[model samples]
Target: MGLTLQFIPYLEIEGLSSIGRIRKLLNAVKENKIVLLEGRLRKEEETELIKTTMEEINSEFKGIELAVIYPESQNMAFFRKAKQHFINMLLGDRQGLTIVGPASVVKEIKKDPNKIQLFTTDVKVKAKRPSKKKKNKG
Candidate 1:
């Protein structure tokens, strides 16, 4: 079966605080669910997220893997840049995504100038059993 994913901050909610979003994201991570965050977190928030995740991690539970992606700017207007900078400052983090989850399923997070890659692995195929000979009774 495939995993069920949920996106946060993708839609504009009337009343949603940064802390609220953080809580929702954290809860989903705790349940081992994949969460797609729209934007990046502030520096303080990033630190907090790491701290919290580290605390929950242990022998059985692997630590969370974070992949921060700074998307290419499409509209480089002065106004747009100013607005983005203001928002980033307010949140105390850069513009990107914060992914958190168990490392058993998530690994080899790669990033390029074009895009980000996650979950790279080698697949092993099992060999089939040989058919038995019809050495019937006499």
Candidate 2:
């Protein structure tokens, strides 16, 4: 099986409803495509996405692993933090990256303040050999 990575820009999902966004992300993940979204989803939307994924979990569709990476604000100065918050509010979009991938394919996702590491599992497929037939002439 081949792996596919799908990139979704903020504008593509900016105007979508909460459910619409979740559906889009979930659909991509279900198809074994890792989705790299430009911006992060709201807390409520994230919760809803998990809920929907849980409901759809089955044998083929194991689930999903989601991660969000953003600049660390804990060590930032008060003024700088304020400015970041202001910018996010003004743009109505969080300055971050969101990754969503199927649990079957994505083994793990590790993140720190500076970078993200995604680990994937290799899927093994068996190829069938064609049968050989022998013809007899009398």
* TM per candidate: 0.67, 0.82
lDDT of 2 by residue, 1-138 (tens): 678999999888888999999999998998889999998988899999999999999889999999998767899999999998898777756578899999999999998777789999866768787877767768
Q: Mark the 10 consecutive residues where model 1 has the least summed lDDT.
A: 9-18
Off by over 4 Å in 1: 10-19, 73-77, 86-96, 120-134
lDDT of 1 by residue, 1-138 (tens): 355456666343214566665666777766766666776665676777778777877776676667777766666788887887787666544356656555655666777877877783344558798989989899
Q: lDDT at 54 for candidate 1?
A: 76
Give Cα-based local distance difference scores for all models: 0.65, 0.89
lDDT of 2: 0.89
- Model 2, runs deviating above 4 Å: 125-138
Q: Which residue window of length 10 is worst by lDDT in model 2?
A: 87-96
User: Model 2, 32: alpha-carbon shift in Å?
Assistant: 1.2
